[model samples]
Target: MIPSDDRQPPQKGLFELYLEDMINLRHPLVRMAERIDWPQCEQQFGPYWCPDNGRPGHPIRLHVGLQMFKHMQGLSDRELLDQWVENPYWQYFCGESTFQHEPPMDESTMGRFRRRIGEEGARALLRMTVELGEGTGTVAPGSFRVAVADTTVMHKAIAHPSEARLMARAHRRLVARAKAEGVTFRQTYERSLDGLLMRIGRYAHARQFRRMHKRLRKLHGYLGRVCGDVIRQKPYGQRSQALDDSLYQALYLLRQYADPKHRPKLYSLHEPEVACIAKGKARTPYEFGSKVSVITTAKEGFVLDCQALRGNPYDGHTLHEGLMRVHRHCGHLPVHTLVDRGYRGSEITPLSNVRITGKQKGKGTAHPEHQHRRNSVEPIIGHLKHEGLLDRCHLRGHDGDRIHAVLCAVGFNLRKILRRLARLFGLRFIQELLGLLRESGTQTGQSMNQVVSIPV
Candidate 1:
């Protein structure tokens, strides 16, 4: 039966669907949507699907575009759809007419679309955004004279796993779901779960050292057996591919399990190859996201290059790649590039035209301003984390993580454009005022010089 919330009138107009009374010009996300080339974005992201043969009316392109805008503004899908229904301006931006009516698009459809398009499509969207910025002169050309770079970790969305707990959970959940769906399982999962959970709880909470060790050993043994059964059956493939990936990763982690004192390698059931990255900060000592490197134009603060670094590589090692990306994006190499102390090294010191701080790579003296300039990227990273939604990611795997990071960067650039446009009038006013002050000062100085000459 449909819930009370599901009941709605059949004869509602498109405008009647939305709750928002109006779309304000001052809304940053709305303004950003205007600057985008909708035609180009559509052409780039438009997938193959016929109108009748497709899911229904309201093309997938329109749905995807609306969803992207919503995410860029950090709105939920339901909220976005509601806003579209009520506000006419939002309807116009989303490619809807005044009288159209059909709930914007199902939330599940958006997820399926993201999965269908994969990370590559998302990256293309980000690239298009960057290209648009370049076309608009928002991204200044060759301004890498002093580029700032930093790294942060975005933690995965899962609890810390244990050898016993992982195996038990996977086994129980898989068996239960399969049984409910009327599938057969060779092993008894309930017994395994109870035994494993009891032992693990002991290991986790036991105060006595001897009891803890015994409980942990038993837990390991039980979980090891469960892992063998699951691997043998390969239940992951039968259920969901995403779940399959997660189970495979959990199995790998179980195999690598050791003392709690040992550091856990970056392992997510969803994205096994995710790297373990560490950026030395007082507040956040460790981060789980890929080592993403971004270089921006010093003058305009436009992103020149953004790439998800493979492995937790050294800061200096990424300089060449970062520069290459910048060159590719801007179509020219920067005359001068500035980096932080972490990038300083003997190998890089002798490089001509590149300005890096800290101990010169080969013993040449470091630049005094390098540290201060390197500090500039700190705020950019903070902005991406807090405002651009890079702080946490909901997608699975490295590719998903990479695409998410790039999108956040795109959002950041769009926001920068919005603020720049807003401040342009104020900045022009300040410039004019400064010019008048300078002219008046010059006239007064000339009068003083003439009076001195007459006295002489």
Candidate 2:
């Protein structure tokens, strides 16, 4: 059931009574907590829950705060929980009234929360961060009029694909599934598979192409035999839907591996949705994952929007949709967009006032500032990949790719806001300290110059 605000309060124990006395109320997290719109978040997220069924869910702030903390720190769910328990500042950020010895929720709870909120909810979190940036003055009111756009590959957490590895993984999955479903196979290749894979790797590394081809063919043959056995045992009519899907994927992998002309190929066995994208990098020639478009304000580094594009389309083709997403999320289209030369020849519908960088060429440009701002997004993308969670996405499927990208942007913006607030508070404290010193100097019948010379 949806928990009511009037739920009975727990009796305060001795430890709870003394908790506030031990914690620092002036911490950045505590100040940020006061600044955040918790009620708005609760209202936005509260609809995902049923009002009359299911057990009472955890507070919305706890779940939301956990997500922000997760991507902000680039931590997994387990690590977030461990750190949350030890840090009182984190607890206060989550709206906890008093410290607790136990974790707020289990590691799996984060997955459930993500699935429940889905992509739209993730975008809401991004919007909240954007709003916070504006309210905190980190991003100026007019900055939203100008946005920078760029695309980067958010690599999937999977091994680099190879012919041998693909065939071996397919064989192992088919064997494991057949055993689980009680469908007997003549030869599972259980003992020989590992050694065969090892030999294939060694052959490839040693530049022995002939031996590598032989092992790959052997592995492929083993997979096909096992697949046939499962089909014969389970048959078309009696097989479970999951078993049928597995067999289909195994067959698809076998076909793609055997042929060199398949247009779209599966790269990872577990994550079939992963795509191999080539971004023309010398060191890293190819990246295996989805392409993400990152939009940020031209002057300030706050992220405006993040969207995952499928099929690895040209960077130019994604501009129209990227602008629409910016409009949808930010409530207005940027009056001008600064992008790198990759976006040249893009079929962006011309807006009379909207200025796009690199579109016009001449000695004197319409907006030369936009061209200079284009390179700013490069470092923003780097920070999103390294400091934010956009380096490697661990969530499943295309939906996971989109949601993870948005959340990473959210984390980036929140971290910036927190730092700005910390600086603001630090300066205020210094100003107050100077005022106190001046007042003390006056009371001691000494000039401010005399007080300035006093040392510890």
Candidate 3:
């Protein structure tokens, strides 16, 4: 059974102090927690859980609160949990009634929670952030009428894809698996493989192509011998799932390098969904990651959606689908969609007025004065990378990419909401201070120049 978040508060003991009394309730995080509908959040995640004989799971708010904190603070799973223990404001945001000494959940439980939510539930989380923005007037519904969209590369957490690195990685993996599966190869190449791989790297760096090629051939021969030994044992049908998948990658890498004429050399053995995206920059010619389409309102810059495009589809081909994602996530679509020159020939669209910002210059689009508004999304994307976790994805496969993109959006909107609340709180505080000062001087019958201290 899912843990009910709407339970009654515990009765305060004679000597116990409440967390609400200890902390400043005017804090933005405290106000944010109060405004969030916890029951609705529990309902969104209730279907994903099953009513078992096991004890009730942790409250959905706790897990989701940690998730938002993870991205908002740019902390890893372990880092977030460690800090969660020290921060009482964070505890209050997660629905804690009293200050806790230990973390509510572990790092592994957080990972399991993400898996349970999946991509659809991740989108639901994004929708909830959007709804939070709307309810607080942080994002206006009318602003969603005109939106800007752009694509960016969200890099994967992998080393540079080089032949030497891949070959060494494969050889080590094969040797480890062979040892684990009780199938030993003839020569494990443990004696001199390190020197050879090192020499190969130095040769390439020193502009010694001939030496690099010679050392690479030895590495290739060593890999081939080990691969042949493992394949002969026929571990495919009987080995563990991980080993089987590693063997497939080894085979793919072997075939990929057997010929020197392979064009697309940028490939990751571990992450199959990663693609090379070329944005035509002189400093960095190609980026190895996934292409993500970002949609935000032209006026408010509130992100409507962030769609991770697989297979590195062309920008023009992704417009219609991006709009659909915006509609699905935000419960509405833009009457006017603005895009850049990359989507020039994108004629087929769900919206009747798909405005190419460059082509429209001042032509037949629905919103002409908002031509410069398309550039608003660029800063938002930049913020997502810098302030949020969209810079480099640390999660695993295709599903990880989708979930991470949506969470980054959630973090972005969360910050905006918090900032708005903080500003409004600041103004209210100043107004109250002025009122107190005026009342103090009037009651004391003193001149306005004389000062009076107000007890805060």
Q: Summarize candidate 3's per-residue lDDT along 298-410 as a digit string, tens digits.
A: 88788888977776888988888888888887777788888888887776775636777767444554447777787898999999999998999988998899999988988
Least accurate 10 contiguous residues by lDDT in model 2:
347-356
Candidate 3 lDDT score at position 274: 81
Task: Output the lDDT of residue 398, model 2.
Answer: 93
lDDT by residue (tens digit), candidate 2, 89-191: 7877776777777998899988999999999999999888887888888899898887888899999999999877777777777778778989887778868
Residue 25 lDDT (model 1): 49
Runs in model 1 deviating more than 4 A are 1-34, 47-64, 86-88, 99-102, 131-139, 142-145, 173-210, 227-254, 258-266, 282-284, 344-354, 360-371, 425-456
Model 1 clashing residue pairs (backbone)? 18-85, 18-86, 154-289, 246-269, 345-361, 346-361, 346-362
Q: Name every residue pair that clashes in candidate 2.
A: 1-53, 1-54
Stretches of candidate 2 exceeding 4 Å from the true structure? 4-19, 179-182, 350-361, 446-456
lDDT of each: 0.60, 0.84, 0.83
Tell me the deviation in Å of residue 266 in model 2: 0.8
Tell me the alpha-carbon RMSD of every candidate. Answer: 9.7, 4.1, 4.4
TM-score, candidate number 1: 0.69
Residue pairs clashing, model 3: none
lDDT of 3 at 390: 94
